[model samples]
Target: MNCGCDEQRRVTVSRRRLLAAGAAGAFAGLAGSQLDTQLAFAADPAYSGDVLVLLSLRGGFDGLSAVVPAGDPAYYAARPTIAVPKAQLIGGGTFFGLHPALAPLLPYWTSGKLAAVHAVGQPAPNRSHFAAMEELERAAPGTSLRTGWLNRMAGSLGADDPFDAVAMGTARPARVLDGPAPYLGLTSIDAFTLTGDDAVKPVAATMAALYQGAPPALARTAGQLTGALARAKALRSAGYTPANGAAYPSTELGAALRDVARLIKTGAGLMTATVDSGDWDMHENLGPAQPGRRMHDQLAQLAAALAAFATDLGPDGLNRVTLVTISEFGRRVAQNGSGGLDHGYGNAMFVLGGGVRGGRVYGSWPGLTAAQLRDGDLAVTTDYRAVIGEILRARCRVGDLAPVFPGVTASSLGLVATR
Candidate 1:
């Protein structure tokens, strides 16, 4: 009756404010765009590695329900009401099986393109949504650095292009992509255009002329804005079509992933991209592994969109792409009274890419018995940062993981291969 996670979720920048910033080409927005303008002045090193896509599963994800531990009898004992029947599982060997809801991803699982790491979470768990997510993005604990880990990673890699660090699916960047590294946020590719600019009234040109003889700071800002507008126009003129017969679901996530694919194909100098999927905090009515239920429908939607994205990318596109999922924490090991789950720790992460060693779950499995649980939650056997560190080093070609993860060491889970 006395659960600890009762704080209100954090409110970020409003969508209207984000749009206004984009339209006004403010200093921060200009800095994000200046990456493009600054390219002409510096010999930009070409990034010939995998594009890392960070999919944030907002709301505490119930990894236990999704990645069932049929091998352990204690699992069913803990969540009798909401437990996914072992017989109804989709992909698994003898000990573990995935919930039937994720059927769409089974093909990728079978083809060795998808995998999961169980019992993974932060070094320390925080139940509050805002606090946990902030820690997750910041990644560094007990350190003075306040920049997001993704930003640090991008900065370390010498990325300066506006497209290098992208926060797609919304009008503003996610906290994970926050910091000094240049990045842009947009709901979609076409929605990135400047507002109130037409043939008769050229806002970009007008601003350029106004700031021609201005101070250095004002002039640089103007140049960055105009330059970004020109590049955006070129991209719009080129247009895009999803290759390999891939059809996005027209949902927020689908649209966002579509644009990410578009930018990658366009060679927009993208290094890291972030997307968000929420509503995983199912504290009630998380029905069985059947259609029309809460968790079932959510997972299906997620699987469908992800499968489509991978299909559209095809083998070639995926070969240069690495997609990973992360959440603040997992659900309680034992289901709460309302046939739902409460905030806990040690969630599961999915890794999908051409170089992934899939068709099997990775990580040391801490059993579901009460003794094995960590204060009523799944005990974390793997640090989430290490999992990402592995992907960064193997697929993204990040030279050093220390700057991005601080004191954390990269995992040798063989989740991805060094090409």
Candidate 2:
């Protein structure tokens, strides 16, 4: 028919117009380009006075070796080979001495800014490292726990945004940081990002929209991280440098700690940052006397890092940070054939900072006799939860410790400064 001419005119369309429409949709994310950034995790807020720096001493630590009970005859009697001499201690105190390895902490102790809690740990008698560590990590002693205590604590704190809680290790480790919330988990705050600049914005928006209704906690956390991509990107582009001629030791923990210092100063939310140090489980070659066997080198390295963190942060930075160190458990009262201490119960926990009452060992000491041992371990007089719980309530402004450490109660050790 003659309508072919009319049909051709009606169906005619320009390539440029079609391309423009497609490009517009992509830019608007209708074609899924507006949002494409993964919003599953990271970045919550800047530190706001209430923050904790958790330093975990992995492996079983020898509390007795760390803080010698020189005044107790049972202590010297129990370990004639590994006992520290009271005379070498920096401060003249009753019934106590510091291991030759812990010389760095002497100043903190003398200044009364360090509170040492001996015979502290969960009552879970299970010595399996995997089980015990998990138990402590969950902050739950008797029951099976899912989320980490730190996660729960953050939940209880009830911040407007959940990204305040942070763990300094890998994306996810054990106990303390598990749960649903916005928690930043970058070993390097330096390498986090949202691909592309202007082009990436549309994709980032699309990605965020895709996760519009997910409940994996990680999903919501992802949403919270969208705004942080820019900040994270900038932190990554800018490198970090230490101060006061403070050089970190060439150890994994030392590096991690240095990173933590950098993040804290950069004004990250960082309510809680955990830095773990492994290799404390000395079953065979723990030489408490020798240079490398037991405590000498390890203590020096630990002290150097702590001192450096404190100095760089200075009084103000030091005041804002609360550093607590713990191990899975303590070592045995008696030395083994391999010249090392075996797994036992009741290790010491160290609280160091400007706010700590310090300079004195808190907690009632349990004797090293067979009858006093809890299944051949030192009897636990102070629960680890009580110490940490009190700090959370007092310093962090999170009054309810029950949820963070479910079914457990806390008593204040008066470790914080009276100000």
TM-score of each: 0.88, 0.79
Off by over 4 Å in 1: 1-45, 163-172
Give candidate 2's error at residue 20 in angstroms: 32
Q: In model 1, how many backbone clashes occur?
A: 0
CA lDDT, every model vs. true structure: 0.76, 0.64
Question: Candidate 2 at residue 303, lDDT?
Answer: 77
- Clashes in candidate 2: how many? 25
Cα lDDT tens digits for candidate 2, 1-419: 11323222121112233224331211110001110111112245642544577777778878888777778777777776666667655555687666766666677778876678888988666577878888787877666678878777766665435233232211233456667643544334543433343463565566567667766654644454454555565666787788766677776556667777776777656666776776778787666544675566777778777877776676677777788887778888887887678888898888888788888788888887788888877889988888888777767767677778887777567878532
lDDT of 1 at 273: 78
User: Which predicted model would earn the best TM-score?
Assistant: 1
